[model samples]
Target: MNLQTIGNAILIVLVIGWIGYRQTTWRPVAIGRMYRLALILAIVGAGLLVQQSHGLTGLDVAVLLVEIVISLGVGAWMGAIARFRPLDPPVRVGSSDQVARFASRTGWWGLALWLVVLAVRVGIDVLATSLGAHAATSTGIILLLIAANRVARTAVFAVRLERHAAVTA
Candidate 1:
């Protein structure tokens, strides 16, 4: 991808992430749900992965959508697991040791699983870039913009969910 597209993608992800982080508390249910939503955003990003690729035919979009659905299913399952699993020990001892420990334990697994999904998205993006003879065209730029909007909207929703949960908790 060219600098412009890359910058746009980065802006999108960061905005969404920031929104989620700002809206949510550090509670497990809220944070876990937010991460789950992040996974969905990543799947959307994956769909846009082939936007600039010449090799991506109509069949490719179908395949990408299938992949997105699969990813969402798996991500939801994993998020449920993270939410229900028993908390583990913290990596450090401190005043807020309980919270730290809980986060550390949960974060390890959550981050690991999310990283794997993210890796797939990155791989697809790279493949698309490689296949494209030119930099991101108008279609690709539009796709990226759409992905950005989706991600940002999802993040805002997640933040709202988090806030609601926090109020209840």
Candidate 2:
């Protein structure tokens, strides 16, 4: 199998193991694992476009490095935002006042981060294309869309999962 397949497999296992462990002995450690997986995914995703057509110039290389840093920084920020007191077996349902406040803060920050990333990408694209310097590499837009989608989905999924747990309780 290819490296991509191997990496994907490992990631899936990590996620499953984290969820299972979270239900058992060490929820905090499982949360840590989930954040680690996010970081790993961000790094892997930053390099999704590798081809002759997407060859990086010196400026493009610098931009890519910056993007990687930003991506990891965002991942760290998300992990921090997600940190909360452990839930008891009798799962709490709906939006707790505490959770609502957390969501507002977290959601605003997450939105701001994505906006900054998008702005940087657009700025770079304008600079590169305008100067006719390096127009080959073009993964930024697609990755930005994907990151936005994933972040939104994560928030929604977390809420839904909490609701389901509450119902089952």
Candidate 3:
């Protein structure tokens, strides 16, 4: 591989590492926090899309949407299986109620979904590149998939937590 390709490979590795680091640090999160994370991820995905060399073809967009759907489905299932606990009180003025979660290790499988998705992404990328495909073309799709997964997972956590609290109250 040339220097640029090598550099890109290194960047991808670093990004995966960063994502893994984030996953490991999960804890109780507030709604606002989760929303912000989702928003940020979405914006990043959009930015990546705009930077693409060619305008999105119908097939590209379609494939991206499909991937996003898959991401959301897996994310929701993963989120639903996670464990959550109330923060003693649902709310305290100016303090985080911790009802929403991006993702937490409190569940049975911990970061299984996150890790699995990440590994799958890397595998797909490697396979695509080996087949002489331009990987950058799919950057937007990849980012969107990541963003969608997090948002879906976060939404699931919020819904479940709210319902859980309601039932107990």
Candidate 4:
């Protein structure tokens, strides 16, 4: 594989490892952090896309749209299935003074959903390659798909947290 492909593989592995660690633990729901990461990924992805867009075909764009939709759907499903509970005394997240009154964990179901996302992404990549949509398999597209997924999941968490706050207050 080329250097870009190898770098993409390494990045994916690291991200998957980090996500897997978070999935099994009851962690403070840091909505701000989630959004920030998503935004950063999106910005970087967009930059990469600009660098690569000249080579993209209409079919590549179509494949990307489909992958984005699937990513968002799976992310929302994972967020919906996550279990949330009140943090006993609440805890500060990151450097922000914003206290997290609730913690959430996804356990096995979230992991399974993530696996489904991975499978669907791989399947689409294969199909896209067969259809001559080379850009569909690019790192920029992969990052964008991941960003879309994270944004959807973060939105669900934010809405749920707001609802919970309303109910409690």
Identify the candidate with maximal lDDT.
4
- Return the TM-score for each candidate structure: 0.41, 0.43, 0.71, 0.92
Report, for all candidates in order, the number of backbone clashes.
1, 0, 0, 0
lDDT winner between 1 and 4, please give it: 4
Q: Model 1, 49-122: lDDT tens per residue? A: 55545565654554455445545544443434333222454233233332321331223454455445455655
lDDT by residue for model 2 (35-151), tens: 344445445555565532356577666655555556556544644454344444433334332222112123445555555645665566567667664532344323433354344
Give candidate 2 regions above 4 Å deviation: 1-47, 52-54, 78-83, 90-105, 133-137, 140-169
Candidates, ranked, lDDT: 4, 3, 2, 1
Assess the local accuracy of residue 78 in candidate 3 as a C-alpha lDDT between 0 and 100. 67
The alpha-carbon lDDT assigned to residue 138 of candidate 2 equals 47
lDDT of 2 at 33: 32
Residue 122, candidate 3: Cα error in Å is 3.2
Order of models, best TM-score first: 4, 3, 2, 1
Which candidate, 1 or 2, would have the higher lDDT against the true structure? Answer: 2
Model 2, position 83, has a per-residue lDDT of 37
Candidate 4 lDDT score at position 104: 94
What lDDT does each candidate get?
Answer: 0.45, 0.46, 0.63, 0.85
Per-residue error (Å), model 3, residue 75: 1.2
